[model samples]
Target: MERAMGISHFGAAAAACVFMLAQGARAEEAGPHLAIELNAVAPAETGCLISFMARNGHPAAIERAVFETVLIDRAGQVERLTLFDFGDLPAGRPRVRQFSIPGLACDDLGQILINGTSACEAGTLGEAACAEGLDLSSRTDVELIG
Candidate 1:
């Protein structure tokens, strides 16, 4: 009987620990949040491709992300290009989206801009929970401006 009681006590303690762990994860997803970053950029056959890494700093998941970029030529002609939308960007994960801009080369790229995000609806976090948090890194010949 004593052994049976001890076993039950141990089982209860383990269950408590599991519950606490689950709660902690939920809390992290609920706290003040929103973060994303651009890790690299590469030139595609048509235009360019940008890689974005989502850090677990946002309370909501990003379904689709949109960005607008500006390109300049040697003759000082400015052009606007919209990158492809990234889908299902979860926290602490990375996603890549490509854009098609004809006749654009690496050297002609002046700057890249992050216009904003759509379909980034806020979940149970709150109305003010969704935020734009991104970091930019360079892997190509152009400069990125977010």
Candidate 2:
């Protein structure tokens, strides 16, 4: 594992964790009450990094997930929308109860809109999305990371 600033890099074992804690941050098709508990919003090589806690919490493990990052224009129109590169997770506990979005501006919100795509939309606790045996919590996060 590569340790940098107290953070280790745990190969593909941590791949899903990285994806969840680094991609599943924000999600909203298009609405007026578009709110989120942002943890840390940064910019990456591909797009953006948005780490946030949904006011509606999410599950610890999930089956499959897709991130939808919306860049809202000043005119309130959907300007930019990007999806995740990964597809699913292993059948086990994940390292993220919250969400993360890579390639985002860590210090800017006035530049984009955001949302997510969950394979397990059922049994979703509050803001979680669970399916098969995978869990994805609903909106109810304490810390806003974005």
Candidate 3:
């Protein structure tokens, strides 16, 4: 009877170890591996345009990518813009996207805040998993805030 009790405890311990290791593996597979570089360029006409680049650094493919951006001016005025949704980005590839802001000029911009990301997914990283892993940078004078 004592021998049977020892075997039961050993089995339980082994099961717990396996469960922990499995969880760790899953976590390792899920993470954000995307980098963003943005620049505000002045057009010949009169307004400003935003140039964006999205690069995937992970081995797995990114299925969907979307971001919510808030543009703040020097006078504390705010304008919200939704970046173009880039779908299906292969690993190690960089995608370029650009858009024009009708009347906002490059100098008028004060700060750009990335409010949130949605529809972000990768092979192992689930939907919206890449939001926290983004490394954002800008070439313009305006500050890129979060």
TM for candidate 3 is 0.66
| lDDT (Cα atoms) of all candidates against the true structure | 0.56, 0.39, 0.75
- In model 3, the worst 10-residue window by lDDT is 39-48
Candidates, ranked, lDDT: 3, 1, 2
Q: Over the stretch 1-146, how does candidate 2's per-residue lDDT look in tens digits?
A: 23663344446558778777655453222211112334444566665555543222233333345555565544555545665423333333222323344443434444433355433332223223421222222232222122
Candidate 1 on 1-146: residue-level lDDT in tens? Answer: 99999999999999999999999997665664544455555678776555555544554565544444455554556766454455555655545544456666756666665555434434554333334334455555555555
TM-score for candidate 2, please give it. 0.33
Highest TM-score: give the candidate number. Answer: 3
Q: For model 1, how many clashes?
A: 5
Q: Give the range of the ten consecutive residues with the poorest summed lDDT in model 1.
A: 125-134
**What's the CA RMSD of model 2 in angstroms?**
15.7
Indicate the residue-level lDDT of 58 in model 2.
38
Tell me the alpha-carbon RMSD of every candidate: 10.6, 15.7, 11.6
Quantify how close model 3 is to the true structure by its C-alpha RMSD in Å: 11.6
What overall lDDT, based on C-alpha atoms, would model 2 receive against the true structure?
0.39
Q: Could you tell me which residue pairs clash in candidate 1?
A: 34-57, 34-58, 36-133, 36-134, 37-135
Best by lDDT: 3
